[model samples]
Target: MPVKAKATYESVRDAVNQLEKEGKEVNPTNVLNLTGGSRSTVYKFLSQLQDEDTKRQIKKPLPELEDLINEQSTAIITSLYEICKHRAEEVVLTEYETMKKRFADLQKTAEHMDLIEEKYQLKAQNFELQELKLKTENQELKEQNKILKDQVQTLKEQITALNKIINKQ
Candidate 1:
């Protein structure tokens, strides 16, 4: 009689993996055929493999999902921040342009007011010169009027003296 080698845990696990690689179902029959184990022993090992697979499936995806969620959150936050910053810069630039235009307009208005003030100042000086000349002319006219009055009085006295002399003759 030929003696069969006893199967170990590593041997059964390798047999199951080989069967899966060959696209075969990892049943107790297939695992026992590869590792030369009893039906009951292959069944026990297969159950252990199934339990481990279930544990891996449960434990594996949580960290991956957390990483993916973190990446997506970071991207969304960065996009929102960029949008807000760009809008703020645009608003500031628009306000700056508007203020610059307003400042220029104010400067023009100030220049116009300055021109009006200079023109009025020239007119006031001209009026002052004309008033001074008129005052000088009035003073000369008053002096001439006094001299004419004195001459008229002297002529009237001479006429009275001639009349008296003729009556006496």
Candidate 2:
């Protein structure tokens, strides 16, 4: 509550206490019936009192209504501050929960990306291995072809030598 609000509430309490000291009951509806204040103002003052003096003790009568009202102002302000603090704590807790959930979601996404990268790396390694095997097989085939060509050339030279000997005879 603002300082002005607290001051207005203090004034209303002072008025009520003065009326009570003058042999009047400080009931909520009587403020309009006895005093000139409206019913709404009386209700507002009662609300301020309820908030300010929940467990407050009154051992002796107050000398002045102004003093009593001023004394209770601190308690009212303190209670209002406590209520606001609790609300702020609730809001902070709610935001913290939301942030925690978002962090968990991001962690899951990162894990999925790691798995995808690992799979791609495995696939690349497999392709390199297959290329190496194909290169080795092609080299062996070229070597075998060279050996077959040499054997055929040697057989043709032997046939030519036999034909020349028969013609000379």
Clashes of each: 0, 0
lDDT of 1 by residue, 25-96 (tens): 988777787888577777777767766775464455446778688657656765776687689889989999
What TM-score, over all chains together, does every model reach? 0.50, 0.53
Question: Model 2, poorest ten-residue lDDT window?
Answer: 1-10
TM-score quality measure for candidate 1: 0.50
| Predicted structure 2, TM vs. truth | 0.53
Off-target runs (Cα >4 Å) in candidate 1 are 1-64, 154-169
For candidate 2, write residues 102-154 as lDDT tens digits.
Answer: 99999999999999999999999999999999999999988988888888888
State model 2's lDDT: 0.72
The reply for model 2, stretches above 4 Å from the true place, is 1-67, 158-169
In Å, residue 156's CA in model 1 sits off its true spot by 4.4
RMSD of each: 32.0, 15.1
